[model samples]
Target: MSSSARPARRRLQRAALPISAVMLLSLASAGCGASVGGAPPCLPPEHTVSPSSAKPGDSVTVSAPDAKCDPRYGEDAVISIVFIDAAGVEVLNTTAPMADAGGFNFTAEVPLNSAPGVMAVNAMPHGVDWCDDTGKNNRVSQGELPLERASCVLPTKPLNITK
Candidate 1:
């Protein structure tokens, strides 16, 4: 190529360097957990029941880690536990508000009348009106409820209820 064309090509290549670097940095930041697409990341919170086995009227503690759903719903999500007996009857239901730091503990007595067998324990975001049983719309188990940034059906974990 001519000398004049060579200098113009060099100038264009130099200008592209900064733009490339910026795009790479943006990608790297997102890969490192920074929210992308101007939306906060939505990670499903996990639930754990201490002891996993409890006797009638015994106290059971449910623990949950920090979680995010929809940014519009923000950080304050209600956590609820539904204790169902072997007969599929709900015996005890409790809703606890989540703390600012996200982690929370909810302790409740296993109803003395809880059908003595393996009890099905389910957890879900109970703060939103449509996502809860108390809401007039009653979409509790619809599985289409939006939780923060994602949609999920409520999840259940099992617990041994001994006599």
Candidate 2:
């Protein structure tokens, strides 16, 4: 109300403003430290397969590390297999939900009519925004296998009885 009191009030307000801001910032940083910086709290899950080589009838076994990252970070983990021919054209693309056990085993019957030479297995956590600390939606690490080219398998060949 008085000139002297006005100055004191302004000073107090200024000091309080900064302190409030610092507290808010600290809370925000703690909640989102992982998305902000430093090595990811946890490296993406690791994946592996048994009998790296397999024919159409043979079952393919796959495994991956647990999805330890918080789901709030965005996107779920995806396991996929890419089949490519000698010409480098993708012939088949297969993907399945990652199991809670961090492992997956599914039998993929080779298409009797499919043309194949080599196949590649890949696994990645899709729809995550590792770069955006603000938590905006984005592809943080999609289609990136923890270890790309983890395994290769050949498909079953058709019988040439006529020959």
Scored by TM-score, the top model is 1
Q: Write the per-residue lDDT of candidate 1 for residues 1-163, one digit (tens) a residue.
A: 7767877866765563332233234333211112335555443356677778999889988877765543233466666778877656789888887654345688899888887767766665565432222213333353323224222234556678888
Q: Lowest lDDT 10-mer window, candidate 2?
A: 154-163
Q: Model 1: which ten-residue window has the lowest total lDDT?
A: 26-35
TM-scores for all predictions: 0.56, 0.41
Model 2, span 57-158: residue lDDT tens: 444555554546632333344445554433334555777665532344444544443334344443434333322443444334433212221121121211
Which TM-score value belongs to model 2?
0.41
Clashes of each: 4, 2
Off by over 4 Å in 2: 1-41, 67-77, 99-106, 113-117, 129-163
Model 1 clash count equals 4
